[model samples]
Target: MAQAGTAKQPNILFITVDQMRFDCLSIAGHPIVETPNLDELARTGVRFDRAYTATPSCIPARAAIFTGQSPAHHGRTGYEDCVPWRYEETMPGELAKAGYHTQCVGKMHVYPARSLLGFHNVVMHDGYLHHNRMRHNVAAKDHFDQVDDYLVWLRQQVPSADLVDLGLDCNASTVARPWELPERLHPTNWVVSESIDFLRRRDPSKPFFLWMSFVRPHPPFDPPQAFLDLYKDAEIPEPPVGDWAMQEDPMQLGLNPVTDKGLVPKRRLKQAMAAYYALITHLDHQIGRFLQVLNEYGEMNNTIIIFTSDHGEMLGDHHMFRKAVPYEGSARIPFILNDPGNRLGLKRGAVRNEVIELRDIMPTVLDAAGARIPDAVDGRSILELARAGSASPDRQQDASLDSAVQGWRPHLHGEHAYGHLSNHWLTNGKEKYIWFSQTGQEQYFNLEKDPLELHNAVNDAEYADCIVHWRQQLIEELKAREEGYSDGEQLIAGIAPRSTLSFLKA
Candidate 1:
C-alpha cells in the first residue's frame, strides 16, 4: 500500500460524463444500461448516493467542478464565449503547482470553448455543441454531426443493418453526410484512445492527472446500430408523470407549459429513450476500453480512478428533455471513487449513501494525491472515508466535522441564467424551494415522501412555516458562504453571502 508522501504519489484518472443522469448506471440500480466498467469501479470503490452538482448547467457546472468554488463565486454562470481564467482556481492549476503533469481531453465546455486554465496539456475533442445559429457567429460548416460519423462507419462494418431514421434534427434526414467511419471517430472512442495512449506512454517518474471527459449520452440522441440494437427489445421503464405542481412545493418556480409539465406522447418518449440508452451503452463501451488499457499496463492497481458526470440529464423527466432543473433526475449524479491501495479507506464493492457535492472532489483528489488541500477549498475531504473503506470512520469523522463540514444545509442552492430566463433552487434535503420571479411562480416539494417530486406542497397552509424556515436558512447559508467561510463555518464566519457581490448573484 502507498502511504501519502512516504513514496511516489498515485496517478489520478478523473472521468466525467456530460449530462449523464444518476440513474444511468447499472451500479446505481438502473435496470437498462449495461455499464459493466462503471459497475466494476463502484464495486472496488466508494459510491456517494446524494452527490450533486453545485450549479447543474453545462459551462457553469464544469467551471465549478474544476475550480472547487460555486458558479456564484467563479462568475461563469451562463454560456459565455470564453472563461475568465483570472477569477478561478482550476484543478489542473493546483496539481501543476504541486509538480504533477496535468492533462485534459474531451468535452470541457469552458467557453470560447478553448480556455486551458492550467493543464500542462489540453487536447480538446468536443464542447458545448448547441445548435443555435443566432446565439453567436456559429458556422453550419464547422458543425460536424458526431452521430453521422459513427453511423456511416457502422454501416460499412456490418452491411445488412435495418435502421430507420429517428427524426430529431432537420439534418437527421439528409444522407449527404459522409458514411465512412474512421477508427477514431465517436467522441467517446476518440477521447478514450487518447486517454489510453497517455496512460501507456507517460513517464513513470512523474505523477500524472488526466481528465477524460466524455461527451455522450447527452443529446442529438444518436448512436450507431450495434449499440442501438443492444436494447432494441428491452422494455425500458419511464419517468414518473402526474399533475402540474401536484407534488411540488409553493416555493418552486417556472412551471412552463412546454416543459416542467409532462411528457409529449408515448411513441416519441420510447424513441428518445431508445436513442439515449444506445448512446449510454456506446459511451460505456469506450469507458471499458480505457480501463482495459490501464489493466494492460499493469497500472490498474497503483492508479486511483474516479468516475462521475458533470451534471445529470433530464431525458424526458418532469416533461423536460435537457437539463437546467432542480428535480432529483437533474440534480443527482453518480460519484464513484476507486483507490485500489485503500489509500483513502476505499473498500472494494462498498457503497455509501452519504450526501456530497462537486466541491468535495477537488479536496478529495488533493488529499489522495498528498497535495496541499488549499485553504480556499470549501469542501470536506472524503479521504477518511476512503482510508477506512466504509461508512463507520466517515460517520465518526463526520460528527467531528459537522459543525464545520457535514450538516445538511438548511437549504441547498442552485442557479441558471440562459435563454432569457433566470432560475434558482433552494432545498433543505427533504424539501425543495424554487423562486423564479420571471414566471411569478414558486414551487416546493417534499422530496423525501415524493421522491419523484410528483406533487407540490408550497401553497399548502400545512407547510407554510417550513417554507419560511427554509428560506431564512437559505439566506443565512448564502451569507455565510459569501463571508469567506470555506464550508460556511468559522473559516469565513465574518464574511456574509450577500456582501460578496457579483453580477451572477443577482
Candidate 2:
C-alpha cells in the first residue's frame, strides 16, 4: 500500500477482457486451457481467487469499475441499450486529477457510445454492438462505418472485410471458426498494437494510466486459425450443470435465438467451450506481446498492471448460455494485481482468497497513484490489505482484527434485472444464495463442497438456517431499491419488471 505521501506513484496499466470466466485460464487450473502467458503474469502478480462482479453484465459491471459505486448508487441494475450515463465521479477523472495522464483504447460500452468518461482521449472500439450503429436507422451501417476505430482500420487493411466474414454472430451465435482476417488484423491484436502505439507517442513527462481493453472472448468466438486449430481436436470439458438446473427459465432463454436459447445438444456445448477457450489463449498471447512491448519500452519494471473482465460468460452453465445470471460461471471473474516487483513491496505470486469486487479497482489505483479518494466511493483499497501482512497493527485501519480476519468482507450483494426477472446473489465464496425474482425461487449452493455448483442445496435440511440468514440480508438490501421487490420483511414476487434503472423515490 503506497498511501504514504513520500511513496512514489507507479504508472498503472489496466487491462480487461469481455465474457471471460474465472476458471477458464491455466493459471486458475483449468484442465483444458494452457494459458502460459497468463500463468506467467499470475506468477508476478497477486491473484484474487474470490473476486467477482457485483452486477454481472456489460454496462452495469463497467459502471461499477469506472464509478466505484454499487448498483444501488450507480443505478444500472441490468443491461440496457441507449441509457444515459451521468455519473458525477469516475476512476480516470480522479487519476488525471492526480497528475496522471489517462487514456483508453478498445471497448468502453459507455452510452451515447462515445462519451469519454473523463479520459484525456479515447481511441474507442466497442466491437460489433448492434445498437450503437444500428437498431434505429433506415440504413444501418454497423460493420462498414469508420466511426469505430477498429472497424475503420480493418476496412483499410481489407477493403471488403465485414463482421460476418468471420462466420460468427456478434450477439447470439455460439459457433466457432478461424478468423477471416489476418492474425495481425484480429481485434485482439489490433487493440494491443493501438495501445503500444499510444505508449510510444504518450507524453513522457507524467505518470500515465492506460486502459488496454480487449473485446474478444465475448462473442463471435473466432480466434485466429492457429489458436482455433490448437483446440480443434482437444477434448474440451462441458460446462457443469446443477441438478436443479434441468428446468429452464423461459424468461432468460427466450432472449436469444433458438440455437442458443438453452442447453442445446452436448456436442454443441463442447464446440462452444472449445471456441471460447481458444479465444482466451489468443487474448493471452496478445497480452504477452503487450507486456513485451512494455518491457522494451523499459516501463514494465515501474508500471502496475491489473487484469480482469467485465464479467464471466456462462458458456452453458446451468443451462445458461450468456450473462445476467447469479451463478459462479456468470459472476466470478479473473482479477489479478501486479505491482512492479522491483519498485513496489507487494507479495509476489500471492493468491489472495479474500473477497473483492469491481468497484474496488478505482480506489486501489487512486491510492497507489497517491491520489485523494473521494468520500463518496464505496470500495476499500486492497493495496492496504496487501500491506497489512507486513505493516504493524497500530497503523492498520482495521487494527482491532487480524489482517486475515480484517480482509474478510462480510458479504457482497449482486443483482440484475434481466431474464424477465431479477436474479439476485448473496455470497462470500464458501456458500452462495440466489433468489430469482419471478417465481420467488431460492437456490443455495455450498461452494466449498461444489465450486462448479453441481447440486442445488436449497432443500437440504442441513442448510435451512443458512438460507434464512441470507434471505433476510437480501430483504434488507432490496428495501432500498426503487422496485418493490421486497417488503422489508419478505420478498415480493413477480412485480412488473423494470430494466432501466429507476429513481429512488422521495
Off by over 4 Å in 1: 1-7, 128-184, 245-263, 386-411, 418-421, 477-506
For model 2 the TM-score comes to: 0.92
Each model's TM-score, in the order given?
Answer: 0.79, 0.92
Model 2 spans with C-alpha error above 4 angstroms: 1-7, 138-146, 247-261, 388-401, 404-408, 504-506
lDDT of each: 0.63, 0.80
Q: List the residue pairs that clash in candidate 2.
A: none
Superposed Cα deviation of residue 389, candidate 1 (Å): 6.2
What's the CA error at residue 27 for candidate 1, in Å?
A: 2.3
**lDDT minimum window of 10 residues, candidate 2:** 388-397
Q: How many steric overlaps are in each model, in order?
A: 34, 0
lDDT by residue for model 1 over 1-506, one digit each (tens)? 23443337788899888778888888788888888878878887777766787667666677667777766666664444332345456678777776677888777665444467878777665533444222454442233233223333445665642122332342121111111244255556768877887876676667788999877666555667677777767797876753563344253322321243343455555666776777777787888888777888877776788888878866656556466666777777888888876555555665555566787788778877877766777666765554443454453443433433345333457755534234456765567776542453567888778877787788889889987776555555445433232353212222222312365435
Instruction: For model 2, state the Cα shift of residue 65 in Å.
Output: 0.8
